[model samples]
Target: MASEDLKEDQEVSFCLNLFTLRCGHSFCRVCINQVLNTKEGSGVYSCPECRAEFKEWPSLQRNVTLCNAMENFISNNPQQEEITGISCTYCVHSPIPAIISCLLCESSLHNNHLRVHSEEAKHVLTDPSSSIENRKCSIHKELLMYYCTEDAACLCMSCTLAEEHWGHQVEILDEAIERKKEKLSDVLRKLYMQRQKTEERVQRLEECRGRAHQKANREAERLNALFTDIRNQLDDLEKRMHCEISRQEEQESLSISDLIQKLELKKDELSRNIRSIEDLCNMPDPLTILQEPDMGDLCDPEEGEGEEVTGYVDDPEQEEADEDSKGDTGGDYGFQQILHTLSNIISDVNVVFYGQRPADILLDVNTAANNILISDDLKTATRTDKKQNRPETAESFQCFQVMSKERFTSGRHYWDVEIAESGICWVGVCYPSIDRRGWQSYIGSTNKSWSLFIGRGYRNQCSVSHNKSELMLPYQIFSAGVRIYVDYEAGQLSFYELCDPIRHLYTFTTTFTEPLHAAFCVWNKYVKV
Candidate 1:
């Protein structure tokens, strides 16, 4: 064991010859013998403890267990004890204990020979102290018994009575030490309390920072998914536009190729006519020309063919009409559609991302009402007309309601609930201890819950309810979803319209004594969080 752990046991039993009496008290043999020697002639004796009477002198027995334990402890811890112990400075043969220390000589001696030292007061002896120089004043070389508070210095009797500090405030050295020690203790306690507060604040800041980073990561993931979908849609639009433009290009090229073929045919016919005229003029070939039986048919092409071919002319308006008839959407139509799509996407994003994060929630199937159906992913919940085959349990809701599986006990969190059909559902939070089988157990039916009832009994109306009390909103909610926010330690639960710019609907303020779970009640359709 370490030195400190063995100090108390060593102090109680340090001698080798230990003995125990009938009363079970153990002490050194030397001490026991001394006590017994004084009571030798007495007819009766008593134990130091328990005071048990003994008719005769009790025999002492060596305590083997205590003797061995002491020996083992001392052997292990001898270095520490010897370092702190005082020894005689004059004993050169063997180590010996010192009885007194002379301040003038600054040495401890056994004093076995008194004639060796002076008898003057300056050489006076006191308890054997290893640091005896501190007892004397530096200038007067006299024992310091007072303190000069004006100079905050230790002083001897002569310094306080005759030195330049004669008029300064002074007090006994022992009293000054005691007063300073008390002040130091008070300062130490305040410092400890301040340290604890700083540590606690540091822990709180660390937690807040961790949660912020987590929220940022989740938001980044959601944005990536959204952008990925938008990119896919744009790619499809580009492909369709390319196909339509290629079709229009092929149709116009075919019309131009047909016109070129007609011109080539007309050129060949004209060349043949020129050759026939030249032969008639050069060969004096009037007879030969007249003899050509089919010359008339060759000289004149089909009567209306030339007129029909030459009448063809490009018209921008006609081409546009043809394009419309053929259902070509290559120009402006796709561009406008893309602009509309982007506008809608931007508007929806403005509503969803309102400088706040969405909490993840899942419906607890075990807590659903009899007719409620949970989607395979445990995100969507709908109330069915037919009852389900579910066993009765304490956690199950009796009405068309279900609670989320996750429980929130501290910090701030918010989640969005998308309503398939407005004015047909209720969304809110409730204590986990809320009732299970009665009307009182239904969400917002008791004081343990707070809920926003949507589109229940009126058109363009919603209400916040608690403890059977309700406050109906005068304004309409065109929002497709609702945002539920809760600050647990702050005791604030608020609801907002999940529309563009996010409007506040209501808030519930009260001390929440239990962890809360997201609760929902739906009469038709479904809600997804």
Candidate 2:
């Protein structure tokens, strides 16, 4: 029981107002003061635990380390009223509260035990519960005071002298940690900025997608409405054709009905005459019969001729022939009617397609052939046998065909070319990308060209080299002026004879795959635009 009481008192010893003398022995400050007061005239003080004497009442310093240890110990074991005093971890000793901890040895020891432990182990010591023992090199059992910048770890002085860390740059641990923290902060700032930009890009893409979807929907609705209108027109045309046929049939039926009514009237008149003759022949008295109306006039053939009635019979063959002729004429009439309607439609479309639009007709001087001379107005071109002295350029056409400056990729256009009297030329349009040096550049010679020839006969050709299919116009049309019309949207190229009444000569139809340029080939003749 006495030993238990001593142990308990030792455990709570650090919690009191403690003081340490030069001999490194700790006791309560009040107890130390009482001892000092009793030895006032002795001119000397003594340590309670070590029994070491000091000269002139040795100065006692407060044990701050022991006070901190006591606070930590109490806080950690708050539920327990008393603590099992810490024992010396290095040597066998009775339980006592520890005041110092060895960092290298990782153990807590009392003052007496710490002196012996530090001498034998050469371990660094600190206040108990300070956790300095954890900051030691495991391999060398030394305090880690330096940080290896290359290895990015805390290291001891012994490690810096070893082969592994030799010549490696190092800094103090606190300074290294501060530099790493600054670098990490910069990285975090850059990451935040990148995230913001990515979010903005995602938002923009979403807006673009939404707009595209809306435009597509609007176009689809417009197309649907246009197709619906086309279908309605077709239906109306069908109804009109059927109604015209029904009207023709009704007119023919009325003619037949009139013929029947006339025949019936003639039949009734003849029957009345027959009944009159029978009554006169059946008279009982000869005098009464002779006296009965002009019997002599009836017997006289010449006089009766005027009284005789002849009923005309309808000719079945004649009726059939008439009907056959009407049927034969109806086919041609229907065909012409359809042609007329289509012509009207084309005329209406032309107004919309070519309404006061700018003319895309300009001569490119760079593309003129060496032997060709262009008028000052840039509207006429003429070829001569003598080659003009002009510098060679990429845009110059090696062949006779020179492309116009303006290129057409869409929309409609019309232009007229007046051929010089008795002069021949080729006028039309060609793709700008066609070979300018080879024979393929010639108008109507390659697939990229379509032209009307005003030479021997007015003929139009398309890719004549591959397939020679040319359409000849009338002689009158050749003598007259020529007009070229293009509906690029519909892929139509039409030539017309500019006579009193314009006559369509020929038309070339194909989907234009590239921008087109009006090309002219003046073969030893002048052609005006």
Candidate 3:
């Protein structure tokens, strides 16, 4: 009866793969499968645990709740009792569960035994280690109280007075421990501060990375916007070119058609005359031939008739001849115009998007002509009727011209000239070694100079490579400034008429053999830069 009660209290093992039947009985899946197989021939099934009757077979469902409970119970009751019993090694009356073990005696003790051993032996006790024996000096058999620095050993007070360790530098153990602890604390503090500095550096770098990412995104957006404009301009230009070509084709086709119609009419008239002449020639009598009404009016064409046919015959060739006109003529004319327009647009875009631009260009009085009067700040120059008293130098221009103190040998540069109080001022770039004393030394008059002139409300550009090109300014106001861009390496000098939307005046292409100086000609009053 006692074994039965114990067995009833013990936990019964249950397979995790359990299934529930309609009769409320739980069993492993294997047992349920065997029962279903055994009752298959009879066409009937029942729960093995309950022995309940069922006519039709019903599908079983897994007992998920019971399976989860079993898993948790098994995990909570994991088997871990390796040493089932611990008995006192010192007690002889009966084996007792140990509470503490003594390494000096190499024995386990119960609470009662441990109390008696501690009262009689008075041995130092710990949970497991024999630290008491280790603390006692091997030779002195006493607790260590001082440390000998000279011998690098721990010693009792008696050992310090021994002959072998006499006169050694000694320190109390407690004092040494305190000093070491303070040093260790200082080291830990320094390490903590270093860690903080490293953390701060990392945070700073992360912030810098974030800002850099933002700036890169902004720059990418700007580039995208710029490319969008470029694409639109290209599309518009393409459409215009196509339209112009189509217009020319239509006009040529119409003219050719009209000439073909006229020629067909003339050919029909000639064929009729030939037929009438053939009929007269078919006459048997010579008198009939002579009497056939005025054959001159029939066979012979009227005067000036050849000229009309010749004109009609030339119309087809006229279209081809028109296509082969002078430089940049016909279809090529539109192409050249578009190329120049796109180049101008791209140049303006570069000026707006690119690097450092020309700023305040201070004019050099020493390089100015004698007839030129420079302002106090050396940014304004005025032409005088009489020459002013000034020191003569080879750098000074003898003509009505003044140059900037800044000289450019390479790289691109841009500067604006505010043409005020003068309708006819010349703004351009020229070689520093250009003839400055002769009548032909005027800007745009020599090979070493290129200039843009605005006078009488007219804008004109002059270069040594091509003849003067007359351009219409967006605005008629001459007081508005003009921007000059010089690309030294590319050997290009471009002039722009500055207005709300800047317009390109002209561009000069030439190889620069020497450094160029920014030259200004104040023909009448004054010009500010």
Per-residue CA lDDT of model 2 for 1-529, tens digit only, reads: 8545544765643434566778888877567768767875665667767778866546556676876566555556443212434455655645666776777777877777755564653465665643654678889878887898888779988888888888889897668878988998899789757865664565466457646645665555654544454456557767887887687667656766776677677668667767887887888877877776664343444532322112222567865776577576655226556555555445433532223543747788888988888878888788887887777687788856577888888887887777766666778888877777877667787888888877623242212121234555544434446777778988888776554334455667688899888889887567777
RMSD of each: 22.9, 29.7, 20.9
- Model 3 alpha-carbon drift over 4 Å, by segment: 1-236, 239-243, 284-286, 293-333, 346-362, 370-389, 398-400, 409-411, 415-425, 437-442, 453-482, 497-503, 522-529
Greater-TM-score candidate between 1 and 2: 1
C-alpha lDDT of all candidate models, in order = 0.75, 0.67, 0.70
Question: Could you give the candidate ranking by TM-score, starting with the highest?
Answer: 3, 1, 2
Model 2, residue 257: distance off in Å is 3.6
- Locate the minimum summed-lDDT window of 10 residues in model 1: 304-313
| lDDT by residue (tens digit), candidate 3, 449-519 | 77776663335322222223334445344446888888899888888766544555667778999888888
Superposition TM-score, candidate 3 onto the true structure:
0.47
Give the higher-TM-score candidate: 1 or 3: 3
